[model samples]
Target: MAVLQVEKVSKWYGKHCALNEVSLEVPEKGIFGLLGPNGAGKTSLIRIINQITGPDSGRIFFRGEPLKPEHVNHIGYLPEERGLYRKMKVGEQCLYLARLKGLSSADAKARLKEWFERFEIGSWWDKKVEELSKGMAQKVQFITTVLHQPGFIILDEPFSGFDPINTNLIRKEIIRLKDEGASIMLSTHNMASVEEICSHIALINQSKVMLDGEIKEVRSRFKESIFELSFKGQMLSFTNALGTQFELLQHSSDADLRLARVKIKQGLTVNDLLQRAIPHVQIESVSEYIPSMNDIFIKVVEQPEEQMV
Candidate 1:
């Protein structure tokens, strides 16, 4: 079941259309990457989902039912712009937010203890938010965001201010939450993170969805029939062997290792290229060059609207 569904949702501010018939689904227990360039309506859509703002037209459903104010309790949102009472104690702040989500004071305290321990921030309980570093404070906010164990979580730039270790830690926690049956909507410009943790993605551009699908399927859709070849033999021999069966788009060499990117002609297979090249060059590896999410994002966002498929 989809944890959240947006159907032909449109939102306008003055004369500016923020979301134009934007529609997408956040699958249950999976991480959905919400991708788009800055000011591309990503924030607008997120706002509507969180009910911070309402759509001007269309509808939103939460688990097959019309979204209502009560549905807010089932959602946990960590926006890109993090906020916390700077003078408040870390544990106190977390407990307060937990209760706001409908948890009783006792339940909230118990849950906060477990989460604080799990995050190894038990010692930070008494520290003021202002006393902590940006990353430290971020960790506190993250714990509170998921403390209530909401079924659906929306995280925007969740890894911001995190170092490599902290980033990986959060990434693992995200996957763990999904494994435990929580659905997540991850919004960020960090394509590497999206590629690593997202099961599906929806790309928004110019107030519209330019692309949406499973991660692998989306990447596959942008493939150019190009392959990367790494060999230890002469580049000239490799090129000569390929002949017209493949077009060598670019090549480079480092030490004895030579790498070349080639696009196979129509009807020609990888086996066909290997069959011809085997006699001339010692093949180390050959793999298809799949475009990364970053590449696809730039391509989709920059391409003329009419040219998109």
Candidate 2:
């Protein structure tokens, strides 16, 4: 089921078209990745969904109803640009944001304590926001953003400033949040994270939705029928075995084991590739090479204007 849907939304900045008749859906549960390169109008669409700005055309629905100002309380957003007050104490600032999100003062304090402890930032509670390092400030913002436990969450570049350990900690928390019944929208350039956590995604390019669907399905849709193999074989014999049935895209040798990628000929299955290789090479293992999200992102967004959506 969909938690949020944007229908034919369009936003124009003066004469600049940021978003052009774009539509997207956020699932009822699990992470939905909002993917696109810079200047693709992802942020514009996000703002419209959050009601930070109104679209010049189309509509947005949340839980099957028209999105309204009150719905903002049920949604939590962490913007790419951090917005904590520099002079406020970490704990105080979090409480203020929580109150703004409609949390009671007592409840905000309790949740803030729990989050600070979990994030191992309890000692920084009294530090001024300006005194904290960038990553530290990021941590405080991250905690406050989700402290109210909203059902719908939008996180933009949620991992941008953290070290590797903290990044993993946040990643784990995001997965946990989804498992605990919260749906999330992850907007960023992190293709690897999208692959790891996003169950669904909508790829916008040149101000249009070029692709949209479950992650696995999207990857499969762009498959080029390539396969990777690992084996100990003579390069010459391997080439000869392939004959005209396969096209070698890449090959490399590591000691005795040879790694290569080939495009399967039409009407040929993976079994065919293995069948032809067994006679001439030791076929240790083989697997289909599905293109990564990064590959698809670059491929779609960089194409000629006539090719992109």
Candidate 3:
């Protein structure tokens, strides 16, 4: 089931088009990655979803109903740009934001206490927001964002200022939230994080969605049918036997081992390539080279015209 849907959404700033006919569906209880390079209109689309701005053309839906002011209560948004009152104490600020999200005073306090304890920041509650480091301040903002238990959450560059340890901490919390039935949309340039945490993704470029699907399906769509083969053998005989069935993209040799990256030609399988080479070389291991998310990101963004063609 989809928790949020953007249908033919378009947004403009003055005469510049920020988003053009953008559309995507975020399913419930899954992490959806909104991926793109800088100035790709991702932020514009996010702002529209948050109701921070209106779309020039198109509509949005929340849980199958038209998005409205009341639906804001069902959303917890942590924008890329951090916003918190510098003079306000951590606990007080959190409580204030929680109430704004429709939580009662008593309930807000109870939830704040629990989150503070879980985050090991109980002592920092009384500290002013300005006195805390960026990461600590981010923790406070994160706690307040989720304190009301909103059904949908949008995190833009959530790992920006954290160290590896804290980054992992938040990543685990995101997975936990999904498990407990919260749908999340993660917007970031970090392909590693997307690969590790996202179940589905939509890649946007030039103010339009270039690709969108489950992670595995999208990855499979970009595969190049290349394989890495490690073996101990004579390179010439091996290359000779395989002939044109497989194109050796790269070849290197050491004292006793030979490593070659081969691309399987059309109508040729790994088994067929192996059959031709088995009589000449000792095969140690063979594995396909599946493109990583980072590789795919660079490839897609670098060839926008080719993708459209």
What is the per-residue lDDT of model 1 for residues 1-309, given as tens digits with 9 covering 90 to 100? 888899999999999999999999988999999999999999999889889999999899999999999988889999988789999998889888988888899999998888888888889999899999988988888888898999999999999999999998899889999999999999999999899999999999989999998999999999988999999889998898888779999999989999999998999888998898889988999999999999999999999999998
Worst 10 residues of 1 by lDDT: 237-246
Tens digit per residue, CA lDDT, model 2, 191-218: 9999999999999987889889999999
| TM-score-best of 2 and 3 | 2
Could you tell me which residue pairs clash in candidate 2?
Answer: none
**Consecutive 10-residue window with the lowest summed lDDT within model 3:** 300-309
Task: Look at candidate 1 and give me any clashing residue pairs.
Answer: none
Clashing pairs in 3: none
Q: How close is candidate 3 to the true structure, as a TM-score?
A: 0.94
Q: In terms of lDDT, which candidate is strongest?
A: 1
Ranked candidates, highest TM-score first: 2, 1, 3
Q: What is the Cα-based lDDT of residue 261 in candidate 1? A: 95
Error (Å) of candidate 1 at residue 101 is 1.0
State the local distance difference test value for candidate 1: 0.92
Question: How does model 2 fare in lDDT?
Answer: 0.91
Q: Per-residue error at 173 for model 3, in Å? A: 0.5
